[model samples]
Structure formats: C-alpha cells, structure tokens
Target chain A: MTLKVYADRMSQPSRAVIIFCKLNGIDFEEVRVDLSKRQHLTPEFREINPMKKLPAIVDGRFKLFESHAILIYLACVFPGVADHWYPADLFKRAKIHSVLDWHHSNLRRGAATYVFNSALAPALGMPLNPEVAAEGEKLLSASLAKIESVWLKGKGRFLLGSLQPSIADLSLVCEIMQLEVVDEKDRERILGPHQRVLKWIDDTKNATQPYFDEVHSILSKVKEKLKKLQAERGVSANESIGRTTLHSKM
Target chain B: MTLKVYADRMSQPSRAVIIFCKLNGIDFEEVRVDLSKRQHLTPEFREINPMKKLPAIVDGRFKLFESHAILIYLACVFPGVADHWYPADLFKRAKIHSVLDWHHSNLRRGAATYVFNSALAPALGMPLNPEVAAEGEKLLSASLAKIESVWLKGKGRFLLGSLQPSIADLSLVCEIMQLEVVDEKDRERILGPHQRVLKWIDDTKNATQPYFDEVHSILSKVKEKLKKLQAERGVSANESIGRTTLHSKM
Candidate 1:
C-alpha cells in the first residue's frame, strides 16, 4: 500500500511533508482537506487525527500526525535515503532534532500565524485584527533573529552546516516560504534585513528546483483561487478579516 | 566513558532525563548545575551546551541537548531495554513522538512557567505578577484539557494504553511533578479538579516509586538549602521582590 498523506498544500507543515517525500523519492497519495470549509472538523478526519490538524499520514495500517514525527518516520522507514536527510552521526542527528523541536513553537508557528492573520484572513473574507497582526509581526521578527543566532550561525549554507540539505533545511524553508503569500510590503519588512536567511531560501530553492517548481505551481493555483474569491466578496485587502477564526475549529 | 548529565532537579525536562536514565538501568554521573547560583551560565557549561539549558548529556565525544532528543538517544544507545518506551512499531512510535512534540510548547513550558511565576518567584523573595500567573494558568488548563481529550483518552494506565509506561509518560510526569513544588493550595487546585490527570500522576509514581524516591530525596535537600538561605535573609515566604529573574548565569 502506498503511503497516504492527508494535507492542504497551503499549510506550511503540509508543504514541508510534501517536500520531504519528494526529496526522498517516496511516493504518497495526497488527500486534501479544505481548511476554508471546515472539512477537518468532520468526524472521519478527527478519527485519523483527533487534534483535527493537517499534514497527517497513513502508511498501510499505521497512521501518524505531527510534522516532525512524520519527517523522522519517513527518514527511518526509508533507510536508503536516510544518509542524505538524517545523518547517522550521533551529534549531527541531535542538532537536527534540536532544530526541529525549536521550529515547532518558534519559527513555524510564529510565521504561519503572522501570514494567516495578515494575508489569508483577508483573502478568506474574515475580519482581520490589526492588533493581533502587529503582535504577530513582532513575534516573527524576534523568532527569526533567534533562529539566525542559534541554528543558522556559522553554517556554511544549510542549517546544519553540511554541504547537502537535511530535514532541518526542508522544514525551515517551508516555514519562511509563507512569507511569499503575505502582502509584499509586509514580507519585505519581515524578511528583508536578514541576508543570510534570504540566501538560505535561495539555496533551498536551487537544491530542490524541480520539486520547488511543482510545489510552487500548486501554490500559485491556490493563490489565484483565493484572489478570485476575494474579488467576488468586494472587500479590499486591508479590510479583510483575520483568518484565525477559521483556524479556531481545528 | 561514563555518561554525564548536567541538570537541575527543579527543571521538568531535567527531571525527565534523570528518570529515563534510571528507569532504563543506564548508569550516569549527575553533575548538578545550581540554578540559583547561575552556574549554567559559566563558560564550562556553555562549552557543553551553548543553549545554556539543563538536561544536556555528554557521552564520549557526543553532547546532546533538548530532553526529547536526549531521551531518544539514550533509548537507542541502550539495547535490550523496553521497546514500549520508544517503540519500533511505526505508528505507535509516532504517537509517542507527537506527544513529546506537543509537550514542549504546550504542557511543559506553560505549566512550568505558571509554577515558577506563581510559587517559585514568591518563594525566592521575588515579586509574583498576578496577571502573568493567571495567563500562565489559563494556558496550562487548556493544555491539560487537550492532553486528556487527545493523547490520554481511553488509555489504560499509561499514555499509550499499555500497562507498561512509555517515555511519553515519563516526560509528562516529570513536567507535572514540578507543580508539587508549588504551595499546597495551588497543588490542591490542580490535583483536585483534574482527577484523571492526578490519577495518572499517582499511577506513574507508583510504577516508578524507586526512581521517584531518589529524585524527591535530592529535591528535598535542595529545598532545605533554599529554605535556610531564605531564613538567613530574614524574608518571609509572602514577601515578594519586583521580578523573578532567571539567575543570570544558568
């Protein structure tokens, strides 16, 4: 049985899992749950993931959620590809694990919330809270600074300082990539001053150009759909509601 | 070379590592880093863990931080131990991993912060902010409810529905155990209303009584020392300082 990944491409963690499977040459069927429609709240999806979150996986009889766990599981299950993504050296592996742990509460959550509040909410016809968005921007900036000083410090290119990309790079890229979906002005302000981070993003894209192309194609389609929907609602971008209420169901 | 763990028993993650080592029959040298003295900030400790966090391990040339990573590393390194803690079964292992991931941002950090701000701060002659403590309490309650509904739902005894405890249970118990350091009234509030969680804690302690005994003994010594120091300062328990500062060093 092929691995089945339940995900929504627009979600950051979902994209990271997709990149992981693609990079490792692992084949998996994608099952999309429309977040805008509250599809994840259905009892069936809840059975698979009680948390009602996306980026879950089902492999034969085994099912799992939590992106980092899925990433590690994919690495260990496909041992042939492990050397590239998850190093066997004890310390190196620990560093990778540390970065993944830090990502969850810090970079991934903070960036995703900011993007959702600032961009997705308006697109989805929800009420945007300026106060929340401002708070999120502050958090995103502080979190990015720490990521630079701690994880990305002294690294040659990739997060772990290796010549090749690891799961850390994949996870980090998927997180910061959400910046592209935000208003270009906010995106530039949030990510502009960090040259090393920008270079890292470029390097990640270069490393996974084909996969990045495919992923970007999907994202562009989603963005177009969002834009048309916003036009129909006749609300200006600045007047759009925050997307956080939509996420409250999960 | 003997394994060396730099930890303070007051820390939830640190306690988890120490308990894991004992439960798995792995022998290690314990180097207590006095949090009060700011010992963790010293250059010597920084060389071992740049994060300056507790519960870091040094095995041979390998040094690892992050309690979850250290727990997994120890489990993998020791052979013939309980597989239930870190299961080989793909989905079951993923479940444990997911819970650990959630624990870091949810239960562990929020709960520990609540205890520190509400109880430890006042105990150490620091002013406790009621507003901050209330916010921490709110977050803790939400997290505890989620744990009940998600991870521990319908489980028998341990976290994974197994009679034997897993590392997930150990990590969780150590975190919740920090609440014991809080004053009796606050402890009553947590243990009183959250019976299932309280029961789980009792069951865990009962299962790991020897380890609990050893840990509590060390904690009691530390408590006595702290009490003596407070008395020498002629400060009563209720007297509060303006802010609770994390000792500058550690």
Candidate 2:
C-alpha cells in the first residue's frame, strides 16, 4: 500500500513533513486535513492518529504521528534517502536529535505561538493578544540568539556544523519560516540581531531546493490575506491595541 | 574517563538522566548543579551546556545536552544497555520518538509549568500567577487524557504499548512526578480521572526499581518544603489567588 500523509500546509511541522517526503521522492498520497475547516477533528482522521493531531501518516498497516518521527522514519525506511539527513554515526545522530528536541520547546514555541497571536489569530477573527505576542517574541529572539551562539557558530552552514541539511535543519528552518506571516517590522525586530541565523535559514532553503520553496507558498498566500485584513481594520496606520476589529476571514 | 553527569535532582529531566544512568549501571560521575542556587547559570557550567540547562553529560571530549538527546545517546552508545530502552528496529524507535516529541509540547509543558507556577514559584518567593496556573492545569489534564486514549490503550503496560519501558516512558513519568509537590486536592483533580495514566506511572516506577524511588526521594523532601510554604501562606485553606506572601524557603 502507498504511504499516506495527512497534513495542513498552514502548520509548520506539517509543511516540514510534506517537504521532506517530496525531497526524498517518497511516493506518498498527500491528504489535506484542513485545520481551518476543523476537518481533523472528525472520527475518520482520529483513526489515522488516535490523538487527533495533524501531520500523521499511514504506511502499510502502521500508523504514526509527530513530524520528527515521520521524517526520521522516511529517512531510515526509504533506502533512496541519503545519510546526511540522519547520519549513522552514533555521536552525529545524537547531536541532530539534540537540535530536533531543542526546536520543539524553543524555536517552535516562539515562532508558532508568536505568528498565531500576531497575524493568524487576527485574520481568523480572534482578537489580537499583545501580551502573548510580546512573550512569544521574547522567546523567539532568545531562540534565535541560541541558534547563532551555539548551533550556527561552527564552520558549516547547517546546524550542528553538518555540511548537509539534516532533519533538524529542515524542521527548525520551517519553524523560523512562520515569521514570514507576521508583520514585516515585527519579523525584523525578532530576527534582525542574528546574522548567522539569517544565513543559516538561507542555506537550509538552498539545500532543500524546489521542495522547500514549493511548500512555503501557502504561507505567502496567508501573508497577503493578513495584509488586506490589517488595512481594513486600520491596524497598519495607527496600530490600535485594544480594538477587536478581527473578523472571520480565512 | 568516566562519563560525567552535571545535574540537579529537583529538575525532572535531570533526575531522569541520573536515574537512567544508575538503572543501566553506566559508569558516571554525578556533579550536582543546583538550580536553586542558580549554579547552572555559572560560566563554568556554561562550558558543559551552552544552554545553561541542568543534566548535561560529557564523555572524554564530547559534550551533549537536552535530556531526550542524552537518553537516546546513552541507550545507543552504551554496549551493555538493553535494546528495549531504545530498540534497534526503525519503526519501534520511531514510535518511541513520537512519544518523546509528544511529551515535550504536551506532558512536559503541562506538568513542569503547572507545578512551577502553582507550587515551586511560591516556595521560591515568586508570586503565584493563577491565570497561568489554570491554563497549565487544563493542558496538563488534556495531556493525561491523550495518554490514556492513545499510547496506553493497548494491552502492553507502558507507553506505545511496549512491554518494557522506553526512554519516552522514563522521561514522561519523571515529568508527572512533579505533581507530587502540588496540593493533594489539586493533584487528585488533575490526575484522578485517568486510572490508566496513574497505573502507567506506577508501572514505570516499578520497572525501574530502586533507582526510581531513590532519585525521587529528593522530590518527597521538596514536597515537604512545598507543603510548609502552602501552610505559611494560608494557601492551603483560603486559596488566595493574588498573593506574593511567597517566601524564599527552598
């Protein structure tokens, strides 16, 4: 049976999983479970993942969730995929795992939550929560600093100083991509201090090629809709803090 | 050189790493970095883990951090350690990886944050934030529901229905142990509904044997201190929502 990936492009990790399969040339069916439509909450999707989460997969009779696991599975299961993605060397693999684990609580938290509160929530009719946005931005900036100081400080362009892009590189880069949906000023403020991070993001994109850009096109579309909503609410000019001008647009 | 472990027992993941080392008989030196004293923030500790988090390990020249990474590394690098802790099979390892990844955003977030805001903060003289505590409890409760419905539903005793405990089981069980420091009524309210989760916690503790109980003895002592703080602040009876009566007792 063909592998099936249930995902929504809007979710960062979901996009990472889809991009990975495309890059590896893994023959899989792309089943979109739209989060905006609440499609993933249905019973059928629950069969794919008992936890009812997105970016789960079904391969033959087996089922799995969590994007990191799916990526690792694809890297290991498919003979065609290269080792640099998840190297066999014991120490190297452990280092990559370190980066992946760090991404969840650090980059993923700051980027995903900040983007949701700053841009997506408003477009989706949830009132702007400046408090959460500010906190998320603090974490987002600190995460970027860690990336610059520890992971990116080495000679190699990718994380852990790996010459090739590993799953950690892809996962973290996709997480940072969520910043693209936020306002340009906000994005610059959060990411501007880390030159190494800016270059590393570019490196990850170039290594993954067409698939990385192909997957991120959805985020761009979301950005446009967010801009229109901001303008309609007069948010861009005056930057009102207390108003709940949010509407159900997306 | 013996494997050197720098950790503080009060930290859940720190204790997890230390116990795993003891249970497996991995030859290691225990160097305590007390979080209570802000020892992890010292420049010397920074050399071990740039992130300044507890439970970093050094073997000869190599250094690593992030408890999940350290656990996986210990499981793979050690020759005599059993395979069930981190199976060689790709699918099984991936499923365990799934549980570990899920633990971060779900169980770890809920247990750690809730325990800190509700109990640890006040004991350490930081004001209690009921708003954040309430949210943490909700997430913690939902996380427990997921544990029961998905991972523990199978016939096997542990998470992912594995007959033996995996690193994921060890990590998450340690996280839930933090609830031991909370108010008795609060603990029952959050965890009482899920008998499977309760049983799984006990099963994990039992499987690990004397090492589990040995490491958690520190928590029992801390629980005593936490209870005293609650009593001193009249937090046990009136349940004041906005009080900084919090003293630096720990």
User: DockQ (Cα-based) per candidate?
Assistant: 0.43, 0.79
Per-residue lDDT over A1-250 for candidate 2, one digit per residue giving the tens place of the 0 to 100 score: 9999999999888999999999999999999998878888899998898777889999999899999999999999987899999998999998988889888898889887788888899766788888898888888889899988999877888888878999999999998998898878888888788888999999999998899999999988999998888888886445443333443332
Candidate 2 CAPRI level? medium
iRMS per model, in Å, is 2.0, 0.8
Candidate number with greatest lDDT: 2
For residues B1-250, write the lDDT of model 2, one tens digit per residue.
Answer: 9999999999999989998999998999999998888899999999999999978999999999999999999998888899999999988998999999998998899888898888899666798888888889989999999989888978899988889999989999999998988889999999999999999999999999899999999978998987787777785345443333444332
RMSD to native for every prediction?
7.7, 5.2
Candidate 1: misplaced stretches above 4 Å? A79-82, A117-139, A153-156, A216-250, B42-44, B123-127, B153-155, B183-185, B217-250
The stretch of ten residues in a row with the least summed lDDT in candidate 1 chain B is: B237-246
* CA shift of B242, model 1, Å: 20
- Top candidate on TM-score is 2
- lDDT of model 2, residue A189: 80
The lDDT of model 1 is 0.78
In terms of DockQ, which candidate is strongest? 2
